[model samples]
Target: MPRLLGVDIPADRPTIISLTYLYGVGEKTARELCHKAGVNPQARARDLQEDEVARIAALLDKDYTVEGQLRRQVSQNISRLRDIASYRGMRHRRGLPVRGQRTKTNARTRKGPKKTVAGKKGVKDLR
Candidate 1:
């Protein structure tokens, strides 16, 4: 295993893939990072020299936030939404869908479980 950005990358995976295991690093960004650090995309994690790993870590620290930094940034984004009091922000505060998707059918995951409507009975209570 190679240590990059304080994370142990699996030995068998290529450097590009290994870097993505870190939080907030996706496949596209990983490839870009590898290029910026002058690391071969095809290079295996275990084959990486210490200096190469350090270069990669330095690039990540400079350009992107991972692990703890990424988490804090995400929390800050949510906080901003709460501050704005926009329609979407209201959805976030109420724990509903932020987008304008119809709640009639889909979006059950966010809209939560469906409620049974009493057909013909109208608004009558079952008791």
Candidate 2:
């Protein structure tokens, strides 16, 4: 395993694939970073030289907000929305879908397990 930007990437994978193990780094970004660092994208992570790993780490540190920092930033953004009382924020605060999806059905993922409501008794039983 090669550690890059505090994440241990799989050594057996190609550099491009391994780089995606870092948060906020996708396939396109990985390829671009490899190109910028003058590294072979097809090369395996374990095969990379120390200087190459250093170069990739340096590039990430200089230009990208990832992992903890990115997570914090996203949390802050949601908190800001909540403080402002936005509709989306309210949805988030309520633990419901924030994208205007109908809650009547198919929101099980956001709403969690169903809570069964007892049906009303028959009119004859009310006498």
Candidate 3:
């Protein structure tokens, strides 16, 4: 395992794929990082030399906000929306869909489990 930005990247995977394990780094960003660091994207993480790892880490630290920082920034954005009481914020407050997704049928993931309601009793039961 190679440690980068406090995350351990899988050793057996190619450098391009392994770099994506770090938060805020997707496929394109990983490739760009490899290119900037002069590291071979096709090489396995386990095969990388210490200097190469250090170079990659240095590039990421200097040029990007990743991991904890990225997570905090995103959460802050959502909080700001909530504070402003926007339509989307209201949806978040209510735990409903915020992106115009219909709640009539397919929002089980956001709406949670079904709550059963009692149906009308039969005439025999009324007696």
The candidate with the higher lDDT, 1 or 3, is 3
Candidate 1 deviant stretches above 4 angstroms: 6-8, 108-127
Pairs in clash, predicted candidate 3 = none
What lDDT does candidate 2 reach at residue 59?
93
Q: Kindly list the per-residue Cα lDDT of model 3 for residues 1-127, writing each as its tens digit.
A: 9999789999999999999999999999999999999999999999999999999999888999999889999989888999999998889887788899999988999877865658844647555
Give the per-residue lDDT digits (tens) of candidate 2, residues 1-127: 8998678999999999999999999999999899999999999999999999999999998988888889899999999999999998898898888987899888998878876657844547555
For residue 105, model 1's alpha carbon misses the true position, in angstroms, by: 3.0
lDDT (Cα, 0-100) at 35 in candidate 3: 95
> For this target, which candidate reaches the highest lDDT against the unseen true structure?
3
Query: For candidate 3, which ten residues in a row score worst on lDDT?
Result: 118-127
How many steric overlaps are in each model, in order?
0, 0, 0
| Residue 65 lDDT, candidate 3, scale 0-100 | 90
lDDT of 1 at 22: 91
lDDT string, candidate 1, 1-127, tens digits? 8876667888899988998989899999999998888999898988898899889888888888797798899888887888988777788887678788766677889877765666645577779
Candidate 2 TM-score to native: 0.81
